[model samples]
Target: MPLYKTITPNSQTTVKIWKITESYQDLMAKVNLKPVALERVLGMKSELHQRGFLSVRHLLQEFGYTDSDLFYDENGKPHLKDGKHISITHSFNFSAVIVSDLIVGIDIEKQRDKIAVIANKFIDYEFDYLNKMEGDYVKKLTVIWCVKESLYKLFATPGLSFKQHCLVIPFTLLDAETVAWIDYEDKKHRYNIHFFEFEGFTCAYALV
Candidate 1:
């Protein structure tokens, strides 16, 4: 069975995360699903995460949805039935879903050793609070990536660069509280980005 958590941003917005411990095949079996139904779902993987999204969508269907109920626009943004807002992401054995009356996004990440090698690529001001010497520093890297990724999903733009456009305020994984912003045209948009690390993975979600 996958571990699941839900975050309620307000009265109308709810974000949910699904974490997996078994292989894709095992997860599919849990829901009595067919893997062949996952054609577009395979695109989410940049490395090993490719098939992860399929599992997430399949799990969603198990709850009360069909694959066709989810659609993507010409700009590659996802839309729910009749155009309700939706954002989705999966990394390794974890996946997340965000549905709101307004714009929303979510991301999940596995703590990996290579995160330190490419910190500058996606994190800006967040580095101020990041010290590689800290305990479980790799977990912190996952948190930062999740924050930036959520911002990217919310921005929903082809050219919105994470490092340049999204900024996460200084925070710690132990603190479990962090802030983030997207300053476009001097109109700063802020979000209360939340982080949680459990069972070797980190998940983040926000509404701005």
Candidate 2:
């Protein structure tokens, strides 16, 4: 059980992160999945994705839930049977879950220079403050990506465009937290964003 870290952003919200260091077979043996989930995992072509899927079940156990207690909406957002808000993400060697009484979202992404190549796809106004020449440019981009990804998960709207609608307020790596907005359909909404890096990966969550 490589439960790497846990965070309580608020009294009602909890974040659990897992550092995936287990073999697919090892992780599979530790979690009991529903029939549909079992079939889904067996059908995955990538062993890494299978392990990531299993690790999330482990995180749900930490939250006192089981595979049967989770389900997905029409839009593919995860939900808890008990009506608590839930969001999940996995990347490379890391996976995370955020459960809260309030709506919330979480994402973990491996920081890679390649992300800069596609920055224009998901980035818009933030470019005004991002300096490609800066030494932490990749790190900053990763954070913005993670933040926007979290927002997307929470919003769970079909037409929400990250480039055109989501905006991450400027912040330095040291700040570790910032604000983000979803400007869609002529209405603006705000969220509190918290993020941090570990083992070459970044984890971020949004709360409203």
Candidate 3:
């Protein structure tokens, strides 16, 4: 099933990650997609994306759910039929989902050098503490990006700017945990951030 790793951040939340080592046919046969989902997969131009989409359904099955039990809101956020919160993310050769009684968000991103080139656009308060001259700069940048993205998905709020609205506290790679806050609409929200790395990719999850 290629269920690479599973983590229970709390009693109510479960995180499942899939390492895409199966053929498209292999994955497609493992899960049944609804008519709309079938059409969506058929419309994808890249086989990698199709596999990622199908792999998510497999994860759902692991949690005793199915494609029919999921739906998306007008904001494009995914929701569970039973009213639990759900967030999904897929990157090259990997996919992940998190289901929790509390609001949650998950993001998986491949480590790349390009993140350094555009770090200014999304980084504000963090720049002061980041040691750009260090060897782990790219890793730090990627973690910050993932943290902000997870928060974005959790909030699902429109017109939110990563640079202006979200802030991640500074921490070393060894910390594996940190804090983040979103200031918008005259409100302040905080989240507990936990992260880990595997095979040159970083995945971070946030919970309120």
TM-score of each: 0.80, 0.99, 0.98
Q: Residue-wise lDDT of candidate 1 within 148-203, one digit each (tens)?
A: 88888877778777888888888766688688888776678898887788778888
lDDT of 2 at 207: 98
Candidate 1 global lDDT: 0.73
Worst 10 residues of 1 by lDDT: 32-41
Clashes of 2: 0
Question: What overall lDDT goes with each candidate model?
Answer: 0.73, 0.95, 0.95
Best-to-worst ranking by TM-score: 2, 3, 1
Per-residue lDDT of 125 in model 3? 97
Residue 33 lDDT, candidate 3, scale 0-100: 88
lDDT of 1 at 204: 84
**Candidate with the larger TM-score of 1 and 2:** 2
Model 2 Cα lDDT, one tens digit per residue, 78-145: 99999999999999878999999999988999999999999999998999999999999999999999
Ranking by lDDT: 3, 2, 1
lDDT of 3 at 95: 95
